[model samples]
Target: MSNKLFCEGRWTEAIAQYQKLLEIQLGDADIYYNLSYCYRQLNLLDEYFQALQQAIKLYPQEGKLHFSLIIDLRRNGRIQEAILNAENAAKCLPNDYTFKILKYLTVPSIYENQEEINFYRQRFIQGLQNLIQQTYLKTKEEQQSALAGIGRLTNFYLSYQAQNDIDLQRQYAKLVHEIMAANYPQWVVSLSMPKLQPNQKIRIGYASHYLHSYSGTLWLTGWLRYCDRQNFEIYCYYTGNEPDPVTQQFQNYSDIFHHIPYNLSAVCEQIIADKLHILVFPEIGMDAQTMQMAGLRLAPLQCVAWGHPVTTGLPTIDYFLSSELMEAENAQEHYSEKLIRLPNIGVSYPKPYIPPVVKTRSDFGLEDDAVIYLCCQAPSKYLPQYDFIFAEIACRLPEAKFVFLRGTLLEPRLKRAFAAVGLNSEDYCVLLNIPERLDYLMINLLSDVYLDTFTWSGGNTTLEAIACNLPIVTCPGEFMRGRHSDSFLKMLGVTDTIAENETEYIEIAVKLGLDLAWRRTIAERMSQNHDRLFDDKACVEGLESFYKEVCSKHFSA
Candidate 1:
């Protein structure tokens, strides 16, 4: 009966039936496993985990259960437990390549110091070497079979290590290509130039799971909106994300839209059938499925934008779409693909819509007189090496409280870092989750200044803060990924807050915290030049010209 309900998509009914079966102690491993799947479908993660534990106790040798547990544990910010679980799984299933790969790939979601970052990075490299050796030893059929599961985890956190990762990226990409090509030789085969009839439009493809209500979506929306629809046929292939209004908007924009499943072969064949003249992935390296897709040579010209802002390292990827303002002169050295620097910020962004209702600091349990230093980013972006910058700013001003999201993995790491420096982070930190979209904007509006993360700068968050007229203090890094806000500020003609180094970053942050007039002056300047930042006509023109030129050149060659 439970199995019937499970197959019929009745998760809640399935859960009740499974619990009833277990009430009289008549359950087996299959019952417990089924219950766990039902609980997971309903988002009862704790319940799902307990059911998995029960199943594991009944059948200790179940490699699939071990794999699921490790994945969920890592997803829920239980990294320490996940690491232990992976190690245990590997010990039990010694011959299982999945467990071995998971064991080596598991790293902390948040780090303690630079030494910790270096340690895991080196371990990752060693693990890659081991994986390469294992792959080389496998038969082509074995390698092809391994391809389905190997992409479950990517080197996602490696990009946040504040270092150039071109070499590591290339190594991983090559391994992926070898596996993929063996499994599906048709996709890896190179295609000739697209010979489109003059009357027919150039079919351009855009694929990503984050095409709905994500920061990645926000970054690439303007490019779609400003596309020359008359000459270009946009094909949007969305994978796995639930359809929201943003998803619908993309569907509306595309000449052909495929809200496809995550099935690898099906997606690959559909894209090949479309015969895209050019394929533009707004971001890569963030999504496992997208990374796998980017490994195949499906389009005549393949390009990736800086949605994730790191080198893909895949030879299958031909170009990295970036910005002239964001990239340094030597930026070409950081990417495996040929870097195509687009004009302005590389995106003609649609400015964020300001919500009407504003909430006060007191309403949100924040002090009215305090200088709210907004550092709202994904917790991983705040590296421990830079925690002292906050401590220095707090010492300069007693009423300074840095704002971050609640229920983050970095909370304890941040608290310990401040405690090491003889300061209690709780006193100077406002860790609250503002869940509503309007409330999110309200928090940004009530803040005094925006503190941009040094190495992994904010793209949509900075743009939203600028919508609130917030003064941003940013220090650009050596790579293009760390220089987003620096470019935005420069485009808006606000230069004082663009710091050159760590010391200058602190100095600028302190000045913003200390003087109300200075903050207002900066905000006023941003407000005056706000129009220059949006509806970037030249960026669209440049992008379109690049498309035409590339198509012509590839055809001639």
Candidate 2:
């Protein structure tokens, strides 16, 4: 009965039955895995972790369990724990070098310096090359499984190190493609696209694991919201996400909605059968399943967008759909795929609605009169090199208090970095609980200025702040990932906050902190012009044209 419930995707009901079964048969490792899988589907992270531990203890040699645990660790930014497990997995699965590569792929969340980051990156690159060069006697199926395990999350941490990762990213992509080719040679060479039948709309497939409500994925929906459904038949492959309202909206938009969470081969076969004209990965490197799928040629023409904002180095990806504003003139060099710069900010992102809330600064334990700079990017993005910005800003404005989302593991690192510069971080920095969606908007509403991270800029967070009429102070960095706010501000025609150098960034921030009139002026400008960002039909129209053009070119006579 538990198995039946599980088969039907009734995760909650199945979990209850599994628990009862487990109470009687604690020795069954497979049952423990099922319980853990059910808990994970429900997003009960701690419960899932515990159940996985029990399952692994019962059967330590199982490759799937180890990979599952490692994937979970990688997802939660538990770098040290993931590395430890990768090391263990490498020891256990000596024949499969994927875990050994995975150990290097996961870097330190908080780097001590450039040298430390370089060390990890070099090792990761070397590991990928080694995998490509070495021989494995493992069967094609086993090799395919290993590739999926490693591809669960690509080298996402490397982008935060503020360097061009094209070589390294492409190297990994080459390795992934090599394995994929070995397993499925037919997909290695692109299949000719089927001709479009009379009265038929283009069959477009969009695949990703983040089709639900998440901040990182918010921009992805903009394309779908305004799509020309009459001209395009959208087929969405949701690769395992807890269904939310956002997921429901995607279902409403899709002609065919498929939720294939496990069984990589089955998903690939299903995609092949769909015979899509164009396949789009809204974001890759975030989900293992999506990453694994991107390595294969299920579609004649495949593309990736800046939803995750890093170039997917896979040779199978035909294009990188980006924005004219976000990418530099030479941006083509950054990606393996052909660069297609869409108009404005590219995606027709709807202006977020931040309802009027009367939450005062004191409600969040913030001083009512202090200059609250929301430095709320994940703790990992706050590099040691940029930690001085907080201290420098605080020195000029004594009442300056930077608000950061609480991260227990890496929060102390930021605090220590502040101490090294002779600043008492507690006085200048407030590590607070990450609030609910509306409350996060309220935090933006309450804050004086939005402090953008130097290397990795905020995407949706910047948009939300703009929606709140908040003034953003950003210094555009070297890469496209670092220039998100630069694009937003340029599109909004508010370039006053964009800084060219560290000195100017601090100066601009200081001026914003001191001059209330100036802040009010910038807020007024945003209020007048911010509406331009939302509900764009032009980008959608452009997307439709792109679809028709690509299909026309690829379709067989």
Candidate 3:
């Protein structure tokens, strides 16, 4: 009965049954696991943690219990505890991929300190080499498990490296992909045309984990509202818990709004049942659940756009939504997805909430005279090139300081990265983790100049800064993160601010820093241009045309 309730998605009922079983002294590891699973399903974090802890305590030797607890702890921000549990779990199940993955998470990084970070980095490399050696020495099943374990470790390291180095991240990704393909040959595939009906209404399904309270939802709103209700139907598949006010208001516009939690196979099955002609993935590789769901070919035409600007590197994704400015013909071959160029910029937007500049230099521990070269992009977006460029800018402008808005969780790492660049911890750097969106806007307004990141461009951040009347100096690269600022800058008529290389990037930053009148003029012009770039009516028109063309092509074919 508990299993039935769980299967039917009545997680509360399932928990009640599990609790009853526990009270009768029929409690077992499986019952405890079920109770924990039910709590996770309900997103009751505390309850899930408690139940998982009890399960692990009751069955200390149970490898799966330890592994589950490790995941729970990591998700709940108890990384140090997760490391300890993972170590215990690994001792019990030496070959378990889950435990191995968790163990990698515990490995300290170079950001911890030069000595410790370097030690762990070398250890990680040695551990990976040993795992590969063991895979070659073990049975076929063991090799597969070992390869998967190595892949997880590769991903964890890649996450940390990606913040500072793009090339290293790419190299790591390539190595992991090759290893996985060698073990699981059927997992990766070269791009191929998708099989589909020649004539049908193009069914465009937008999939996102943040179909609530995020830029993805905001950009998609006008498009959904103006979709031709008769010829083309929009299906929104959401994987998040908090349904924002916009989400509630926009549901009436979509043909269907799926609020189910992320179950990749289940989501795929639902998409197949709906027989979507064109599946649009709005959120890129940010959510593992969405990525897993996307790997399944539920729709004939699967396209990716927005949310994450980077190429997903997944073979299942068919097309990438881009504009002529972002993707030239030469650049298309580099990406994993086929390039589909929209007539205008691929994304549309609504006017942003431009909060007044209320933050003073005193709030961030800075002087009013300091020329602030602020990077409003999250610490994760701070690539090594960005660090070099910003540091160079600071070096050139003695009076300029770098202010970074680090996430609460990323403050320590951000500080370490800055310190590595020879900047004093408090002399030139200030870290503010603002929880309120309005406060964030106010903070952006405080900066004299905004510096953009490469690999993953500042989408919302760039827009918000422009809305706050700040001059943003950017350089468009070959990929999504590289080109985002270019697209926005072009739309806003700020082409003069786009730089070509490191020299040019620094030159532009220095020029902006020195010329206060020019900065004020550009900021004023950008503020006026923000309306044109983020105009809801213009965006809706472009979206309607794109939808009609997609439907026409599908129907005609």
Better of 2 and 3 by lDDT: 2
| Candidate 2 segments whose C-alpha is farther than 4 A from its true place | 1-85, 96-98, 135-138, 555-557
Q: Candidate 1's residue-wise lDDT over 352-409, tens digit each?
A: 7887655788888998899999988887788888888888888777889999864366
- Badly placed stretches (over 4 Å) of model 1 are 1-23, 26-51, 61-64, 75-80, 91-97, 136-144
Each prediction's RMSD to truth: 3.1, 4.8, 8.1
In candidate 2, residue 517 scores what lDDT? 100
Lowest lDDT 10-mer window, candidate 2?
406-415
How would you encode candidate 2's per-residue C-alpha lDDT over 366-470 as one tens digit per residue? 988999998778766777677677788887899898888755545566577678777787888787776577678778899999989888898888888999999
What overall lDDT goes with each candidate model? 0.84, 0.81, 0.67
lDDT of 2: 0.81
- All candidates in order of TM-score, best leading: 1, 2, 3
Candidates 1 and 3 compared by TM-score, better number? 1
Tens digits of per-residue lDDT, candidate 3, 1-557, equal 88889889899989988788788895778888888888988879789889988887778777667867876675554657777888788777776765765664355322333454455556556655554344442467765665545423334323333323333333434444454455545434432323344454446788777877787557777677666666677888877777878778557778788877645445656766777777788865566556555555566667787566555565567677766557655766556677766645666666777755677877867788999877776554554334456556766787887777764444554455557777654566666767788767767777799988765678877877777878888877656556777888887887889988868988999999999999988988997777667744654555557656665665566
The deviation in Å at residue 34 for candidate 1 is 7.2
Model 3 pairs in collision: 164-384, 457-481, 477-482
Which residue pairs come into collision in candidate 2? 152-288
Candidate 3: where is the Cα deviation over 4 Å? 1-91, 94-96, 100-201, 263-266, 363-365, 385-388, 407-425, 536-557
